[model samples]
Target: MIIFGTSSSTIHPAKLDGGCCPFCKTKNQMWIQGYRKYFHVFWIPFFPLWKKIYSVCSHCKGVFEKKEFKDQELTTSFEYFENNKIKIPWYHFTGIILVLLLIMLISILPFLTK
Candidate 1:
């Protein structure tokens, strides 16, 4: 069976200063991260979907969704990270190449057999 799933990569850490982490109560110790959804077959990520944002408490290691951060500073930080974030090419539509190659092989198979 083909495995379908999503994956995550560290787009950015807590490089810039920010507010405190609610869970750990540590000032300026929150990290902004993201999870990029992808489709996988045979455990290989093929196609990517939308990405989601999260806040990680550096001290307590508590994870919070984007909506969970109600603080103004934290909200602004999140928006800043998102705006400056860069998109990697390999993280997108990885399965399209495989699909196209398969199609080409299938179309040529009958001709080869004849």
Candidate 2:
């Protein structure tokens, strides 16, 4: 995410002291994994809109919007493995190809039928 404008600062869980929860202030704090700030853009039929926002405290297994709390902090994490890998199923590609073929067929059906 892009952090624009002034007063934009990123804080991490490690940097935070043993303080109360920014949300509940109940001292139930957890580690923050990653954080980012950006504008969430939405396209409307006649207008384009955007909301400047921040995402924080994702590592605690809880998602919170920046507006939900005060004194927002940013965090990040990195994990590496020797044999880590990600796989994409063949059926997923096949499904996409099938959808494209169907759309093409529909678009040309009128011409073919004539």
Candidate 3:
């Protein structure tokens, strides 16, 4: 049986403002959102299979992808999070680290027999 490895979803708050909902025409109700889909083992993400950017309408509950945003500001604002806060973490390498430790232990085992 597979003891590890899974997929996870995360949502991040965006640092954007001054956007209106195109559907409800409500001002200051739109917000930028970041999404990621990644593979993980031992609860640590290995790598993100896909990344997505979106703008959601708070009042209308509308979801808009990058190209779906009708407002130019919303499209441009999505670029702000590209390298800011949405980057993958280095701790996602826990699985790799475990493998390396096992390799090192095997390599040193012969020396311990001396």
lDDT of 2 by residue, 24-114 (tens): 5444353433322222222111111232233333234444543444443322211111012212223324434566788999999999999
Q: Where does candidate 3 have its weakest 10-residue lDDT segment? A: 1-10
Best by TM-score: 3
Estimate candidate 2's alpha-carbon lDDT, on a 0 to 1 scale: 0.36
Each prediction's total of clashing residue pairs, residues at least 3 apart in sequence or on different chains, is: 1, 1, 0
For each candidate in the order shown, give its overall lDDT on alpha carbons.
0.72, 0.36, 0.69
What candidate 3 gets wrong by more than 4 Å, as runs, is 3-5, 42-44, 104-114
Ranking by TM-score: 3, 1, 2
Better of 1 and 2 by lDDT: 1
Query: Model 1, which residues run further than 4 Å from truth?
Result: 1-16, 86-89, 100-114
lDDT of 2 at 60: 45
RMSD, one per candidate, in order = 4.2, 13.2, 3.0
Q: CA lDDT of 72 in candidate 2?
A: 31
lDDT: which candidate is best?
A: 1
Kindly list the per-residue Cα lDDT of model 1 for residues 43-69, writing each as its tens digit: 566877777777888789898876777
